[model samples]
Target: MDIIDLGMGNPDGATPQPVVEAAIAAIQNPANHGYPPFMGTASFRHSITAWYQHRYGVALDPEGEALPLLGSKEGLTHLALAYVNPGDLVLVPSPAYPAHFRGPMIAGARIHNLILKPENDWLIDLAAIPDAVAEAAKILYFNYPSNPTAATAPRGVFPGDCRLCPQVRDSVGS
Candidate 1:
């Protein structure tokens, strides 16, 4: 029997040698033998901050605005956990990825699925979410380079901070 590998829609790429060596070194270090900081190590955190600064030209405060996580997927679920209380409405797009559903499901959340038809170029009309659902919704799960469908939405689809809605964690690969 052939075993089908149905991923939770995660990227599959080899860790670069340099990154692997660094992880090895950190593991070998006696200082790292203990529990790691909840936020993460200063070196990695600084590296992340530097990336955002260099790419976006925005200096992030590592202490407040930035904290490193094990992975973006885990961080996203944790975001749902932090903000989405039970019975809170989570707005997700139709024909979506699993985590976009699962995260809120595990958080005991109800979804207000926003259908995205091809005619609209896969962008949601903010006006479409039912007035009651919009008022109740706590978080919106979305993807830009959409999974399964591979549709790319417009930049102005969501508001100023909507960039983060599907910003860092929604990528998928083989």
Candidate 2:
């Protein structure tokens, strides 16, 4: 029987030649053997900042701004672990990457799932959140260009003043 597997996030094709070559080269290098520094090498951090500058026209201080994580899912989960105490309220969009909520779950935080609907183009309706729930929420996780749904959200979807952080209005301009 022939089966089509779509659930796994495997690439449709073999690894690109340049990438494959680079990986092989790195594996052969003695310097790449041991575990890297916790924050990654200064060169790697600098490269990240440079990429941000080139791609988004954003200037970042490599030492302070660039964080080289093994993967976004792991980083996001660790972020929840770092900030969430048991019973803290976390707002998570349903139909999201499992890691978005899994981290908070592992931290023993109460999850308030914001159900996304096709009618809303899979966008989170910030206005739909109850005032009380918004006020109590400690962590709010939202994904744009969503993983499985591939839904994109407009900038206007985010209000200037976040209910969780009223002071962020100035920082997050309307």
Candidate 3:
């Protein structure tokens, strides 16, 4: 039998053998059936922080900074609902995954779309953002290896003071 996954970005292929074996093993274990902690398991959080430290040399506290979510869409939705108020300005890149802007829209935020241009290799032109807009924006959603466009920004693209933006949430590898 063949299976076709016509779902959102799912690969048209069989499940990897190792992953399938792992799933079978987990399903057979009673401990794996229960719900996990809301903040995720300590080991998972520790692993996340450790990955950050190794990959980017950034130190993060597992208990305080690391959060393991089911997926990016769900997490971003909750984040927007929790932080953004009605009419608050949010900066979202144009031609992005719906989740990038949908959450803010649902929160009644005023979205300012950052246009990605082929001339700029689809990267957001940080310098072009007006001073007033930058200052007024409540949150900026940035994605690299961007959805649809496949754009990637170089390291150090963000300014030291975050280019005067108050909150920047980067959704990498989306």
lDDT of each: 0.74, 0.85, 0.82
Candidate 3: count the clashes: 0
Candidate 2 local distance difference test against the native: 0.85
What are the RMSDs of all candidates, in order?
A: 6.6, 3.2, 5.0
| lDDT by residue for model 2 (101-127), tens | 899999999999999999999998888
The segments of candidate 2 whose C-alpha lies over 4 angstroms from its true place after superposition are 1-13, 50-61, 161-172
Taking the tens digit of each residue's C-alpha lDDT, what string does model 3 give over 1-174? 775332345466799999999999999999899899999999999999999999967899999999999898898888999999999999998877787789999999999999989998888888888888888888888879877677898765665555653233242221
Misplaced by over 4 Å in model 3 are 1-8, 159-162, 165-174
TM-score of 3: 0.79
Model 1 residue 130 CA deviation in Å: 2.0
Among residues 3 or more apart in sequence or in different chains, the pairs in candidate 2 whose N, CA or C atoms overlap within 3 Å are none
Prediction 2 TM-score vs. true: 0.81
Best by TM-score: 2
- Looking at model 3, the pairs that clash are none
Residue ranges of candidate 1 with Cα displaced over 4 Å = 1-7, 10-38, 159-174
